[model samples]
Target: MEKLKPKLFSVMESYNGQQFIKDVTAGIIVAIIALPLSIALAIASGVSPERGLYTAIIAGFLVSFFGGSRVQIGGPTAAFVVIVYGIIQTHGFDGLVIATIMAGIILIAMGFLRFGSLIKFIPYTITTGFTGGIAVGIVAGQIKEFLGLDMGAVPSGFIEKIKIYSESLHTIDLSALLIGAISLGILIFWPKITDKIPGSLIAIIVSVLLVKSLNLQIDTIGSVYGEISASLPSFHIPEADFKTILQLIQPAFTIAILAGIESLLSCVVSDGMIGGKHRSNMELIGQGIGNVFSGLFGGIPATGAIARTAANVKNGGRTPIAGIIHAITLLLILLVLMPLAALIPLSVLAAVLMMVAYNMSGWRQFVELLKTSPKSDIIVLVATFLLTVFFDLVIAIEVGVVLSSFLFMKRMSEVTEVNGWKYVEDLTDEDYINDIENIKYKKVPQNAMVYEISGPMFFAAAHKFIDITVEGKVKKNVLIIRMRSVPSMDVTALRSIQKIHKTCKKQGITLLFAHVQNQPMSVMKKAGFDQLIGLNNFLPHTDDALARAEQLKCS
Candidate 1:
């Protein structure tokens, strides 16, 4: 009873006091912001507007209580629209439910396995690429309404979609385009004009009012979607087969990855604002549970909403109370105010989606990376971007990861190369090269050249050190390999050195090592490399090895 009493007290803490009122007000404002977005995203995902509300109400509340970050509002977001639409088009809503549920299970398992930290390994190029890609996809999906095309259904495949839109260009409805253009303009400029109110919602209201007062023959939710029921969600069980589950696995995995990335990114942002560290694994577990319940309740995909989360913080949200209130407010609106949304113009929704697409694109960062980043980074960025835009996001991510790794290995191999120069750096002239020789060694004598190698001597970079070992290149009879900089070695490099030694023996040349770092020394010693070279040939520093090399040259 004593333990339970304290827990009860903690729940009541956010409910009472002057802070409660502020929380309630902030939550209501956030709820208003979430209202149209939830429906817009749900519609974009090829589901009912009610599914978005259900997601905002159920998953939104549960995530608040169990999530790791403060002020993070969970609901259906623009990110999942493309995948959901594809899944629904291919497998129907039941398939979407199964995939969402399966994805939730995967998320929970990831949390229990403590894999939240692994999300950091997902390259930024891939994230940004797919994000911008999805944004474009969402905007593309909304084009029918944006341009008021008399199309029954939009195609899913990118090329086919473009072809359909291009062919349907003549069937444009001028009213829808005008409304959408005006709404998009308002969304873009409303913030600059005023920050006190939500621009998207305002645009929706104005667009709805304009059509209503002018009596324009514009299509609305009432005409197209009919009435939306506002109530609590009922649970549903999808009948799923192995083939369906298997087919869904790729998309399910995509959703899990996106959820993991977006949620944690939101957590990180909230942490920066509040100066707090969140329990990443716990948060993943919460997200999994939330998604599981959300799918069962006829909801679209849900994740942490960064905009609403930031709004919460800006509005004095400190704990989960604000998040809970946000959910509660959504519930009230769904129950009491949903039917009224029937007046909202589809064009306005499309305009909102366009603004969303525009906001999600980190164009400045993309341009900056192209300009300042290295060749490898730029390649990954551009490749990921093009693949995402032109092909499947799943393929883009998989290929992007593989490409990034290969590029990294190539760079490592380049960094491992050790070479010599003819003219030694006169310490006086070293200033001309800006003292790059400190991290590097300068030119030395032709015959007893001591090449120093540093960095990871793995197979990738290890092959480059052998340029000095090639036939007819060495001017020295006794060459010393100073491995003071090498931190490790692999079997490939070890075997390559053996082949180098055989070639050296053929040409009657000797090789030695000075201050061979402990790690590489142990590896070479274990590999019996020292036995082949003669144990006495290995010295502790450059001076001793150089003396022996000079002595051999003299002889």
Candidate 2:
């Protein structure tokens, strides 16, 4: 079980001025990188640009203050864009607020219940598939903004969005295209010039200047969303009914699951960079607190941003202080300079998001998995990806998890086996007691036989156990069973063993066991199978069982 203690408390005892300076510098730099990204992700999520800043300021502050990771930067992330858009479109902004709040409660409960370690059970193929799908969805959503197409509301469906974009191609504004191209060029090449300032900030400044000087007829944030709010976010409760809460359960769960996965992943990555361990459950609680407040203050869902967290590490951030400073810096910018954000062209932001989407895509890993992974993994990957792209994320994740579980069970069943022993000269199969154990050299009475069971004995493999152990037609005075390789047993497999004991009794054959491991032994003892078979029948080794069998034959 993980202790719900924040990293801040642990690091502060040894904190010094030198490290504080580094933290301050790192935090400010991360804030600069997060500014445009927060805004872009918010607009992409179908909300006003200022809501992004609100998330950065509010959620960002709370997560850092209470989070488990030393330098994790929390804010609006690209992963939530598609889901946020869909939720808002289907249920409206108020409904989204309610759903986000519900998600916060779910996360909080998960943290307290110690479910942090279980997040790893979600298959890697599913995560990769959905992440790539999200990247594609982001690109699709940005198409209109990137091309400056004259169009109304874009469809949420991927195929419909593509069809709509194609029909609207003729309406592309060349000036907006030029801005997007120039912004992308700056982003690609500006880091070579200097790494002190973020390329995104530079791109936004240049794009704003270009629009102002050339009087380009492009859609700026102000033109689209009106004057950006410089005032602080106001608190308001989202109204909901019993029916609405029930209806929003799936989406809320989706948000909670994604937030948990991404935040923990960020913690793992940052732990490697800083050589520090993070309390995963604590991080979940921090995220829950951040999100709950973020919704109350009119912001979208937020989580630990991997890119910003990495940037914090690279720039000398070593404590939660850095993350705290980053949030404060964003707040200052929101109060002092938020109005200027409206002057930036929407096309430039689109290009920034396109870069984000490309990074999120992970195409290299996807291709490698496709080429080298097993056929079952390939099916999960493809199924999750297609579902996310064509359908919705809720469906993609639900189906992917269920599919992976079934495939895992199938693989487990394949490895389980029950085999009768053979003489060394007959064949040296590993499954049978052979020359490896030198058991074949032992003299076996004509009235006795032996069998070995391997792998986990679960419900899926119970039938195989019955077919080989109980259904055998051979009648013998004594029977010996080996189970050294079996690590565990379930109720179903225990029942099969019971069947074998009953059958052996009815046939007037003595049933004996050898090399039973702890788990299976416990199950048998708990179920009173030991008493049923008689305590003396359970032998420590095959040699003992064989000796006992000889005595039984003589009797």
**What TM-score does each of the candidates earn?**
0.84, 0.95
Q: Write the per-residue lDDT of candidate 1 for residues 3-73, one digit (tens) a residue.
A: 11111124456566677777777788888888888889988888888889999888888778777666678
> Local distance difference test, per candidate?
0.80, 0.91
Clashing residue pairs found in predicted model 2? none
How does model 1 fare in lDDT? 0.80
Q: State the TM-score for model 2.
A: 0.95
Off by over 4 Å in 1: 1-22, 420-449, 468-480, 488-491, 497-555
Error of 2 at 342 (Å): 0.6
How far off is residue 215 in model 1, in Å? 2.7
Q: Which sections of candidate 2 miss by over 4 Å?
A: 423-443, 469-475
Quote the positional error of residue 219 for candidate 2 in Å.
0.2
For all the candidates, what are their Cα RMSDs to the real structure?
5.3, 2.7
